[model samples]
Target: MSLTHLPSLHRPASHGAGVRHKAQSMLHWGLSQGLPNVVVKMAARKGDLQGLLTQAGSGDEIWEVIDQVRAQGPLVKGRVTFITADHAVVSEVLTSKAFRTGNPLDRLGFLATASIRLRPDTMHPLVEPSLLVTEPPDHTRYRKLVTRVFTMRAVEKLRDRAETVARELLDELEGRVDLVEQYCSLLPVTLISQILGIPTSERRNVLAMGSDIAASLDFGLSWPEYRDVDAGLRRFDAWQEAHIETLRKNPGDDLLSQLVHVQDEDGTLDMAELKATAGLVLAAGFETTVNLLGNGIKLLHDNPEELSKLQQDPALWPNAVEEVLRIDPPVLLTARFAPEPTTLEGQYISAGLQVVVLLAGANRDPHVFEDPTRFDVTRANARDHLSFSAGRHHCLGAALARMEGEVGLKSFFDRYPDVTLLPGAQRRPTRILRGWRTLPAQV
Candidate 1:
């Protein structure tokens, strides 16, 4: 998605008007983010669980906050949203019909909601049309269509290809490398691009666009950050439109091509819906898997005993992937809203209340997993983790992510048994997505 041919909506009106646009963007940020951040900060000082979750820095810090939330009980009130760390409560909130996916800004004031709604051109990835926020009939139809291409049988057909991609990516690495940029990121991006029929030459550009737009999942953003993300979204929009047209004219044997031509009893998806689905697949197809791979590498590196267990019994690879996801998931948290009054774990939830389910926390709930904090490869019931969420909105690509995580991590370690994580590794700054941005490694 290059910016060379962006539509007028994305382009500035005139040289002088650039300053006016900047001022408008700043104002928008102030209403949509700045004020909310101030409230959160104040709540943090007052020891609010939600506020502390946002302020938590490292993985240890995040776990600490999760422990605090758990100590409070099943459901705790935050400054803006309800908080839950109990596995049972989190599962109930996600699976129950009483709670539904909603816009993050629903609770914010009218001015803040209006500020975001005013910019229809810069579509937030988490907003409407995207599968993440859609509910019921439309979501059901979209999921059915997407499910045809991502079933276990279908994903199994791609296993050989996934293995080949992982081997090829690892073959390019030398003694020292940034595992994220060179291996972890490339492996899944390459496969997802193939599924989408995106050309090999365009993968790097697509990856960059995905990374920039990923920040949209977080609660707040500064003016500069939001501006850059908006630009990236515009570029992606332009590119996706052109690509869809190309596919319409000349289809291929790819999942995207199938989506372009597939039909149901209710007829086909409109252009906008198609773009939203395809874009979600493109971004989501890789973003989390990259994290899974990186986290697996770090976890295995830190626990040589666990690594040795896998080396001794290659069959444990699949279960090890679950353990990695359970121990250090890619996504930190997700929010759900109660459409109507609901009762959960004996607590009454008022209508329109937003419940923030900490997936990372739920995965480590002691009631669910024994010795929750330990990174045990052989732990029973590791697959019970909420890393892929649950119920209606469960990850459509869960099977594929597991395949990629297993193939990518296993291939990396088998190729470089002596590989060690270097000191310069850094985590991504975004609060929602949790993973390493740069994982320096020595083979």
Candidate 2:
């Protein structure tokens, strides 16, 4: 189908006047976030797992909450959702047909639901048409088309390029640097940009947009914060539309260009699906790897013995990436909803109820991994982490992220074996997506 023949894309309505915009923002914050925050905080005071998760700021803090959840049982009831930290239960929820991806506000009562429905122009990665929340047969179709473009062989082709970029990035480093900014973020963004055929000149803008849009995943965003996130999404959507048009005229060998032309018996993707898939690929393509690289660097630096082992036996680099993911994952948690009444691990879940799976906690389940808290590069089951999630909704860029982590971390450590992590490293202040905001290191 011709690009013009496809369905018209839905763009978010322009921001209203100052007073109106402020009022809308306040309404959105109160119903969609403010009220929910109040409830979760109340639960947190009572030592509830769901509330503790919202309050968790660091890896240590989150793990403490996870331990409390685990102690409760396989499935624990929370104020708004069902919470699970057990590895078996988490795995089941992610893979089962009984559960499906859901919005956080689904169970936040009538006001929250009505608030979302009132905003028809809302756009975010978690919204439908984006593969993150899309269900089959649409999801099945989208995944098939996207997978064809991101095949293992396609990712492997970028390996040599990734290594080259890592080497250049490291070579340019001098005494002190914020590795998160200078190295970790650059490596993956550059690779993902190339994958999407984004021009070098536009990459910095794209990175900034992705960073802002990422706030959509977090809950309880303040009025200004939500406004900024909405603006970023709109900017990205506009740019993506223009870029798709450009590719239609002058297609290249990039995965995105391939996606533009990909077809099957179901025909082709409409403009909305195209934008959603492409936008997701661009954002998710780099976000996880950026975190993995930052987290891996800190994890290895703290665990000198593991670093020494990797230096002694280079073959362990792959498993070292897995170990980092298990011990300090990029994504802390994800939620699944019961489309209908369902039983999981003998716990009956009412229809429309949400299940928040603590992936970081599940990765460290004592039943699944021995000494779950310890960082072991050689741990045989390290790859079994739910960091990239699992089952049908598993991260599409897992292989690419793993490749980037292995190549990026190995290259950095191999070059500066005596690298020292300086003080003042700060973790990103996000609860769901975890990583360093600034990781200063001296080589």
Candidate 3:
């Protein structure tokens, strides 16, 4: 659609002062700009997004601001505007209800028609192929095949495997460790190998190849960088092909074999659908999890008090992880396109225009939340955050990601009681994947 609007993260999450500050900020923005698709410029003269967020909502009270945007985001219209990632329209599309979210899309477009341009100029090859880029029926059907191998029951069966990888990563953390490299990288890589039945021995090769594609997200390796992109894809496809071929010859007790057996009333899955399922699961299951783990840890370190509280009471860490997801979700934007012409907040919309939703913003809306800015883990509504997104395409691996985070964080704090950030490597700069390339951690 030519149009406007999106989903929510409305909340009233505070006691008093925080709420007032957020309310005032929301009122100011409402009066000034009246909410539209604004681009948030962070690299500013003065702390940038940090300053803006502090002004409108206490990190604890961002929810209310998020709520206001959800209730009234249609009026906004800018190719790019400035706002925190956790604002109103942003969060609404995340955490499962995004498709139904109004004002965002009303014409037959990418989201409405499910014709994801797996070849968008902005989308990387690996990224475009994932289930996130598809819509219902296809997405649901393909995901069901992969789900057969990635069930909660199966993931629970993977706890030992997960912890084993976590512990190995911890063991590698000596005097200092690139927390992202050591832990975040390990679990997902190991999980990919385990799931694909790609043999632990070949994991390093597979991961090394995928890492280039993953790094492309932060570094931008698109059509312009087709050579590097194609090279990485070629390498991965070769390895995957060899592995898949081998699995077909001698199947084992892993995801590939299980998927091979997956069938419903329609008999076995088609080749492309099966590949799509495996490909999305393997890549997303690994890449996104690593980003989530890294981002979650970096967030805790960014807020020392929160980290300290988490360390002191491990029970609080789970909620803290949820808050981290809300505060700085790994995948910040999920796209949609209108199926038909529709109007939103006085704006006329036509079919075929793509509208992207910012999950981070919805988590910080003001109307629903009292103080939508502060990062209080104990806050009752912390779990309501939309990092996993909403609607049919909600993250299928959410439960798995949560379990991994809870275990990873708890295991981490138990070992390094006095964890602190040093001069670590910088994060990859990307609007899509929100995380660091490296974050130094010292005991």
How many residue-pair clashes does candidate 1 contain?
A: 0
- What is the descending TM-score order? 1, 2, 3
The TM-score leader among the candidates is 1
Q: lDDT at 378 for candidate 1?
A: 94
Question: Regarding lDDT, does 2 or 3 come out ahead?
Answer: 2
**Candidate 2 Cα lDDT to native:** 0.85
Ranking by lDDT: 2, 1, 3
User: TM-score for every candidate vs. truth?
Assistant: 0.94, 0.93, 0.72
On the 0 to 100 scale, the lDDT of residue 207 in model 3 is 66
lDDT of 2 by residue, 359-413 (tens): 9989999999999989999999999889999989999998899889999999999
lDDT string, candidate 3, 31-138, tens digits: 222222122223222433322322332232334443443444433443322232334444432333223322232233444322122122223333433576666655
| Model 1, CA-based lDDT | 0.85
Off by over 4 Å in 3: 1-75, 79-130, 215-226
Better of 1 and 3 by TM-score: 1
In terms of lDDT, the poorest run of 10 residues in model 2 is 2-11
Candidate 2 C-alpha error for residue 252, in Å: 1.1
